[model samples]
Target: MAGGVAAGLVAGALWGLVFVAPRMVTGFSSVDLTAGRFLSYGAVSVLMLLWAARGPRRVPTGSQALAAIGMSVLGFTGYYLLLVLAIRDAGTEVPTLIIGTIPIWVMLLGKPEHLLWRSLVPGLLLTAAGLGLMMASPHAGTTAAGSPNYWRGIVLVLLALACWTAFAILNAAWMKKHRDVNATEWANWLGVATGLGALVLWLVAGSPARELAAQPQLPLFATLAVATGFGSAWLATILWNVASRRLSASLCGQLIVSETLFALVYSFAWDGQWPTPAQWAACVLFTLGILASIRAHR
Candidate 1:
């Protein structure tokens, strides 16, 4: 359990770093950057899958094959699109606020009633308060710190969370169905599938023309995209899954907050965008609310 929590924290930290990398990759629209990432990841993932599978394996059922395709689209295609857009437009601070939304998402999806309209009142209130802080935070608009597409950034982050949450739900079911496979093997192959789907999605969205026209970010964005699509997406998933197996679901849930914490600290320390007192207060209140909600769930 301790190992799992520790692994989760490590994964979260890496993801936080990757989340900030997209903004550094110049010229690519968020979509373009994402397209570049998927293209690279598809290549890398296939190689890894080949190495893992050792040339030949038994064929999958029609249903299982379909599940892989569906998972690829839902988990990779949807989530990466939203995540790239959010990071590109929002800078880094605004997305920190969105990370606070995950616990509520997990809880609302069939958490025990005792933690809801009954015994868990304090938690419910705290969660609500945290959400209020997030929504009320001055960073929620289209003019965030001089950025042009501020509101779009906010919406993009929320959409990322929605895609990710749905992915998690489906993933749990997928794991149960494929319990016979080693967890690592399942993850590696699914990553291969997801990368392929992302590539198809990218080409269909007109990446080649965009890449030719928007050339300022080719080398830089390609680096970030590879780091993000391959390392963050694949490696992080592998680590998080290992950790999730060891940790309690609730603890696993709370550790996600660590990513926002890491991102904010890095952004503040490096970018010199010192969080205002209001932002600090909001962050503290948000943490308290999450703690309250977690306790309530228990």
Candidate 2:
């Protein structure tokens, strides 16, 4: 369990950096990024799938498989699409802020938090205030319908958060109940499905295979995509599986909020563009709000 907690933290930190990737990788279309990531994940999954198939296979059955699969779609594919959309439409800050609210979203969605009853409103109010404060960036202060792109990105980010929370919860359940049904295999199947979906989308969008293919050596880009999607994600889930075994679901949920802190620090280091003091203050407030929200639930 200790090992699992450590792994989970590593996974969480790795995930925190993902928000930076879409902003970094150049010369790739949005579809390219999605396709590259899933395709690589699918390739790796196939290898693992075949290896496991040749051995003692502990694949999931009816309900477990269904739930795991649902999680993959929501957590993996849906999250990626929304993330891509958010990144494309708005810059990183907006999407990052939306993602910052994920713990709150998950907590609110759970309904029966194990918190001190009176603290719920205070926790929630503080967190929401912090989020609002973050939104008040001097440059980004007004979220008018004026910039469809920015608002669109914001909406997608929120959708992504909701989807990610659902995925995380279900994944925890799956890992808890069906210990034998390997999450990697589950992820493999999901990646395959996502790759296929991307393929179809690619064809529909008139992006020729020739386009991705002609780029002499897109293998690195595609491989990185795969690693981030399948590799890192699989590792993260494994860590999550371990962590959940040790921690309460709610506690684990709270710990997960720390990813935002990781993201903020890393983002600043990765990109020299720091938000104004107001933005930083808002982020700090939101972090406190999240802590308060978790306390209320406890």
Candidate 3:
């Protein structure tokens, strides 16, 4: 269980890089960034799949393939598109706060036996309050003119939250039912699915290549894309699978709060300043919530 918790934390640290990526490449549309990152992710996944195939493993049937595609669409590709759209249109705070609610949803969707209402409710409330407090920080504020479609952005992000909650719960259920399906292989399949979706997105959105060609920061953009694709998407997915298999859905959900914590740390680091007192207090609350959730399992 401790190992699972650590895995979840490490995955969160990797996933936290995603929040910084958009800010790094502000010129690119959310779709463009999503496409490029997944393209790179797909490329790496192909190599991994091929390497893994050399070993003796059970081949997946049609149903498993369909499941992988479903997970990829809802969890990876669709989720990314909506998340990017939300961040672009609504600014980061709203989208992020919406995403922060994923743990609550995950707990609700998880196995009933794992949920201890007594401890779980307080932890979730604390987590929500901490998330709200984080928004009060200067770092969460956006200077851009208000998005005309702010409400649309909220809807999009909420949809993303739904997609991810489904993915997390369903993926965990699938893994639990099929113990033979190794985490690495499953993660690779999802990566392949995301890559294919990226292709479709690129085709429908008028290739991110043209957008890339027009930008002077091509090298920087490419670097960020590859780095995030490999580290944030590919590797993080694998680590998340490991944690998912080892931890209960409810516990795994609470651990996701670590992503917000790491994101705030990254934000403060980017600003070349330490966290404000309120931010630090929010961090404490988030940590306490995680601890409280763990205690529920006992």
Poorest lDDT segment (10 consecutive residues) of candidate 1: 110-119
| C-alpha TM-scores of all predictions | 0.78, 0.78, 0.93
lDDT of 3 by residue, 221-264 (tens): 78988998898888888888888999899888988888878876
**For model 1, what is the alpha-carbon lDDT of residue 159?**
83
lDDT, candidate 3, equals 0.81
Worst 10-residue lDDT window for candidate 3 reads: 138-147
User: How do the residues 1-298 of candidate 1 rate in per-residue lDDT, one tens digit apiece?
Assistant: 5566677777777667656666565655655666666666667767776775676664557877677677766667677778777766776666766755665565456344344445445554565565566557665432355677777878888888887766655665566456665556655666767767766666677457755556875677667778877776777777777655554444455556656656666666666567666667766765665466445544
- Candidate 2 regions exceeding 4 Å error are 1-5, 111-133, 139-148, 182-200, 203-206, 215-220, 275-298
lDDT of each: 0.64, 0.65, 0.81
Q: How many backbone clashes does candidate 1 have?
A: 1
The reply for model 1, stretches above 4 Å from the true place, is 55-60, 87-91, 110-149, 209-216, 246-251, 277-298
**Candidate 1 to native Cα RMSD, angstroms:** 3.8
- Tens digit of per-residue lDDT, candidate 2, span 1-298: 3455466557667677667667666667776776666666666666777887888766555775566556666877668778877877877666776787766665555444455446556656666676677667654423233466877787888888888888767666666676555546556666556656656655665246777777754676666686676655656655666765554454455556566666656666676767678767766775676566545544
- Whole-structure CA lDDT of model 1: 0.64
The clash count for each model shown is: 1, 5, 0
Candidate whose TM-score is highest = 3
Name the better of 2 and 3 by lDDT: 3
